[model samples]
Target: MMGPTHALSAGVAFLAVATPMSHYVHHLTPATAAVGTVVAAGAGILPDFDHRQATPARAFGPLSAALAWTIGKLAGGHRHGTHSIIGTGVFVALAAAATLNPWALAATLWLCMGLAVRALWKHPPNRPNGKLDYRDVAGLIHAAIAAYIAYQLVHSGLDMGVVPWAVAVGYLVHLIGDSMTEMGVNWLWPHPRRYRIASIDTGKTVEKRVVVPALYVGLAATVYLTYPKWGPVLLHTLQPTTG
Candidate 1:
């Protein structure tokens, strides 16, 4: 799937999961949910950093290039190494260690890895070269990461209760959205054979037809959901403030 589609799908997932999770956690503050959504969307994008030549690496200049080069050199280029399950696990561990919030870190890492694996196996066209798809392994790693994150979110010191669920839901949304595309996600990879829902040719059109509308609708819904009563609040906070 293209970057835009991935991003839109990720955003939709973020909102879909965050809203309900927030309510469940009793932290239904608009601000917390919104922040969670944004974070989830960003997590969706993190896996694509494997594409060294992509705009993101280019945009960051030497720093991005260096990072991409290192990843490529260490992992064997996009979709081959870093796009694998093992790679995702490594990343998740690193992220968790860095953040010192093992649960949140794990969740974000798992979500990204799962998405990556699904993308890799389902959309063979994305891979171009035929190779053993390790997406299933990646998905497992993602699951582990997500589980850890969930545990942390529930037990962590943060007063907020909804962030972890929102993040996980957002990630799930990303996976489901990818499945709708022509290059459907590898719902099952590293099995006897590869399975996919859409063909590469149709994937682009599917993205245009499905993801675009969904993004617009999601944005509208988010705005409506977050709208203030009595009067609109200017300069909305990323997270809702406690009175």
Candidate 2:
């Protein structure tokens, strides 16, 4: 699958997870949700570091390329090591260590902010010509919301334990994505055999053109169907509490 597909899939998976931050760290503002969504998406594809040419690896730049080389060497190449149970466990444990620690929340805050900043960078909060444009206004609004999210996460001193689980879920989503391919992933590593119920050729026209779209559409439909149950939760989480 392509980078966009993996990202969108992971984002959808994140939406399916709950965040304790809603009650402890921060309210479930759109900004916080957006940050969480991006984190989950990145984690979803993080296991692909073994494939240097893989979308996630390329997006991370040269440093990631080197890491991919090392991972590839250790795992005996892509879709072997990181695609297995051991890899998933390692990722989850590491992520939990980072996300569940009180002090580590600062790094997580910075990470989320960076993601939000990069997204709004193209919108430019100010124009060189001195005239304000929709982009500038939009950028300011985005920055403000993200800043608020970062503040809550940083000062609340709450253990954002849910974040790591959400990321792990995203990784599982990636495994599921790989499972639907002809070159099935060895999900249960050390056990051998790439297990898959159905196989679709990865990077082929069918996958990019047909399968990806279908998955997204299905995701959208699921969201729509489930919105009724989640809508009230969002309202309560985001709405200001009354004294």
Candidate 3:
């Protein structure tokens, strides 16, 4: 799926779950909801940064690849290392330390970790080119991480409002959207080994078709869910707001 598509799906998923959650918790102010939603969306994209070696990253410049390579090297190269549970935990720890928000950090970390484990366990050594399917593994790891983050945001006590629910929804949508593509996600990765769904490859025509519409629809949903009248008005009035 395209970057926009992925982002939209994740964003939409976050909003969907976050919104309802906000209502349920009733403790999360509008600002908290917004922050949580944004964090969830960001987490969704965190894993794909591994594509720096591919053409997608080339558009930016060699620096993009270099950065990705450096990060990959640190984590465990392509898929086996940083893209794993251990790596996700490290990232969560770092995020927590940096932000000083244990709940948010933990949530994001959990999202990525879950997905990575699932992906790693599901697609067992079916490399097409005899080389490690680094890209595949990386994608799955990231997806799992993204899903976990979304889940955390929705359930976190920060907000029991609609925003949290929206975040969760958007994240799930993102995962499912990715699954629809030829690069199917190992939704049941660890348990259901060698499982895959029939779909278009990433960056393919069919994949684009599915992704584009999904993006627009998700964005629309986010708008509706975040609307002041329909959703929560957290963005505007929260004490000790984040900059």
Candidate 4:
């Protein structure tokens, strides 16, 4: 699956289960649900840190590029160690540990937001003769959004304990998405055996035309179901006022 598709899938998955699971999971709150949704969307693209040219790699100019390069090398190339079940557990552990320190958690949230925005937000079309590519403009906008969300998340009084679960679910969702593609992921990495159920081509007709669109629909439906009051709020905001 491609970056946007992966993001949408994870976001949908998170929202779909967040409400029902909230009953058993004491840390969940409205604020946490909203924040976790975004974080999960970003985490969906985290495994692709093994690909130097992937969206997360280029999201933050040279800093992220360097980080991606380093992770890619350490993970032994794309879809290897980082795409495995062990990799997912490692990410969850790291996320859990990061929550112990406020600064580390803030940085992690910021990076996740940046990755999600890079994948999910629509960029302007490139100009044929312009000196500045609009894609750069979009990048600046995404960075601003990421920074704002990160700041809000750091300050929001919501419980931070559920974040590691969000990270874990998002990472697993990404692996599952890849498992549906023709190039399946190795669930147990070092063993070299891959598990697959479907053969959808990444970014091709099935993905671009079918899978992504369906995921978008699923996201919308899940969001509606998760946030029932949002519909009334949206309607109230959109309703015209008369003196």
Best by lDDT: 4
Predicted candidate 4 versus true structure: per-residue lDDT over 1-243, tens digit per residue: 678898989988888878666778645766677778888999999999998767787676556667888999988899999999999988899999989988778878988878888787645432233244555556566667777777677777668877788898789999998998888999998889988979777556777888889998998777767567445655675689978
Misplaced by over 4 Å in model 1 are 23-28, 84-88, 101-195, 200-210, 225-243
Per-candidate local distance difference test: 0.49, 0.63, 0.48, 0.80
> Candidates ranked by TM-score, best first?
4, 2, 1, 3
List, residue by residue over 57-108, the lDDT tens digit for candidate 1: 3323344445667877776555444443454456545544534565555454
For TM-score, candidate 2 versus 4, the one ahead is 4
TM-score of each prediction? 0.53, 0.65, 0.51, 0.84
Poorest lDDT segment (10 consecutive residues) of candidate 2: 118-127
Q: Which of the two candidates, 3 or 4, achieves a greater TM-score against the reference?
A: 4
lDDT of 2 by residue, 1-243 (tens): 655566668777776553444556445544446556667766667777678666433332343346668988888788998998899898788767876554565554444343323322333322343344564455445545655665677676444555665567677888888898788889888678898867766566766687667767866875676566566767777798789
* TM-score for candidate 3: 0.51
Q: Top model by TM-score, which number?
A: 4
Candidate 3 weakest ten by summed lDDT: 54-63
Can you give the lDDT of residue 49 in candidate 4?
Answer: 90
